[model samples]
Target: MSESVVADFVGHFFAAGVRGEPPTGRIVLSQRRLVLAADEVKETIPLSSVFDVKVGQVPAEMEGYFNDTITIAYRVDDERRVAAVEGSDTNIDRFGTVLFKVLLNGTTALVRHPARLGGRVTDADAEKASLKLEHGSLTFKRKSGPFTVDLGTVISVERADRDLGNGPHPVVTFRHIEDGTAATSEVGIDSARKTNLLGRYIRLRYADVQEELADVSLDEEELEVLVALYSAGEGVSLSAVVDIDPQPLTLLLNGLAEKGIVVDTETGTKLTAKGRVVVGQRLESVNT
Candidate 1:
């Protein structure tokens, strides 16, 4: 690979994977691991565990655009993960070459550069509905329905123009992670940027999900308890929540109070500052 490619490969990059357009983030190479990162997510895998690596492309609609793509599939114990990140047409070859060399070397290297600004997405539909990102899941909800998708289950993210003979316009499609499955959704956001944004956001956040959770403090039952108290004004009895029967709720409350996620008074329970912060993440999840 050329020196320019090597230089560019080491630092932060604007990477667009299977999703819409590119979201800004960086990839880190270490002696033992490879890390892919974005604003809200970080995925790291052992070099020995990475069994597959390839450079390829998805078809491009326009003539001049580069179709260069880099994809990786790796295992963490019994779990497997795959990611595809694309580079621009002019630089794709170099980017892949440099990365391949480093990984092939099988040695640790350290490089650092200030992160550059990456693409961002905004949507009007997001204003009408609530969109949240959490625990490797992306959820979009309205009165019509609350649609939740796991990032690990994502197949592909695409922005293209198709002609069914009637007309041609840009559309963004998200596919399922399962084989032989069609796209989960294919709708045109108002603009290309907005469409790209949603897809990138999902991919970036998905990287951070752990295959097996080991922390009891942040477990689902505990989070639900905080959310329940956050939603309930002043306080509500454990009997009010249907998700957990009273016995389990009773067991959970002791831990929640100890962690300061909630405050229990003689009459009822409420969220503490820490608890409110955790619950507030429910909305920030979409903002990402």
Candidate 2:
């Protein structure tokens, strides 16, 4: 596969994670192969299983954590099973105080620390997870809380805390599930409305196309330009490709050319091999 294709696949994989689907893609982070898929994951490393859990405040820019919060980081045997729960006391009306109470009760959930010999925790007999120090690794899992988490379905973890003045209240930030990252840079904002709408369209259309449309590296407008050029079947000036103002179209074409997706020749503008494949995939998508 081409580098652009690989980048696109990585972007989509991250995007899918941000969107909360069991992502199916291979990303070589730090030269390690991490595979995320729907059913099973291979050669994946959990951030918590390998790292240390630090209790502090999540950055203000990190969406959910407004006041104070605690974070857990460890590497899991498989990176794909990562899950996070983030909540704050401020939104108690919406998210409840289960996660916050866990932090206050000083009780850890059972899922955080798995048994050496794998076992299961059922709903009826579930208990709070405790922090266990084993072989230089700290492990624990949450027990009684609002979240009904499946051990096999987690992919990332985040936690937030709020100071209710009397004491510190904690919340769980569920990071792996799709919270509309594609629709908004930060969650829980007015702009998220539009982001969610566009995200829904991408999710709906993503699976229909073939020829590895996993990563096209083009935004909506760039994709539109490529599609128009492909549909024209001949070299078309930048103006003819889009109805929008000329300056933005020129910038988009320039960006595509820099990415090796399009070429600007003396004749006019045309799709490169990569661009053609993207256009063709999109075309097929529209037809089907």
Candidate 3:
């Protein structure tokens, strides 16, 4: 082939291989193997099927070494073929480049610059300027400047129309992110709904309740557990619930104990009289 033709062929080959397609021809160099696929590989490999690809040679019987062959180590590019056979311990810069390529290729939504702020979200001015959404976590930038809202801190994120110096800044408001009792009651009402409904009464109810509860709340997770406890007839063991880790649960329980919402007696957790009343009142308010 001419030089130009050869270069073009190589480019096609590289692209094909990177996309997991079978190439018209194969290239093998010593222990290295490259297969160009004839067809295009799907966008992303299933996360579950991703396994480490062993590259280079290793001593026989070394852990995670394939057949004890000691060569240049590399991992599988099962997820992102760009670095499918990248060397082990790849430099951070190179890894970042490959990761970016993978993300682009996969067309994933990545947050380049997440919002950084915190505190209560409200119709009032002070909270609005501090509003942000960082990595799906709700935050508010303080009037003083940038500040990170702690994960456990309760905040409101109201969605309003882009202000154009017009009337009532288009309030199509809803709760942005809420945890604790608010989240719990919302989840409960959602769960209690029957499948057959004429309209979206339950969902509308949920939206309204969410907005209301957002106004008055505590730690999101604690409220969630409390709601769960109430739903389970005023008590649930720490082991039964999924999604929440134990350390947070311990902290939440302690917080509730201090607030008199939960009593940690030797018999296990039961809502204090005040706790029951608080939970009931919250539930009633949300439902209304």
Superposing every Cα of model 3 onto the true structure, what RMSD results? 18.3
Model 1: how far residue 220 lies from native, Å: 72
lDDT of 1 by residue, 141-186 (tens): 5555655555554434566663222246565455432221222344
Compute the lDDT for candidate 3. Answer: 0.34
Best by lDDT: 1
Mark the regions of model 1 whose C-alpha exceeds 4 Å error after superposition.
Answer: 1-22, 57-66, 106-288
Tens digits of per-residue lDDT, candidate 2, 72-138, equal 3334444423322233434221221222222222233323212111122222332344433221112
Instruction: Judging by TM-score, tell me the better candidate of 1 and 3.
Output: 1
CA lDDT of every candidate: 0.48, 0.36, 0.34
Candidate 3: tens digits of C-alpha lDDT, residues 40-80: 43222222222222223332333242222112122245323
**How should the candidates be ordered by lDDT, best one leading?**
1, 2, 3
How many pairs of residues in model 1 come into backbone collision?
A: 2
- Best of the two (2, 3) by lDDT: 2
Model 2, runs deviating above 4 Å: 1-216
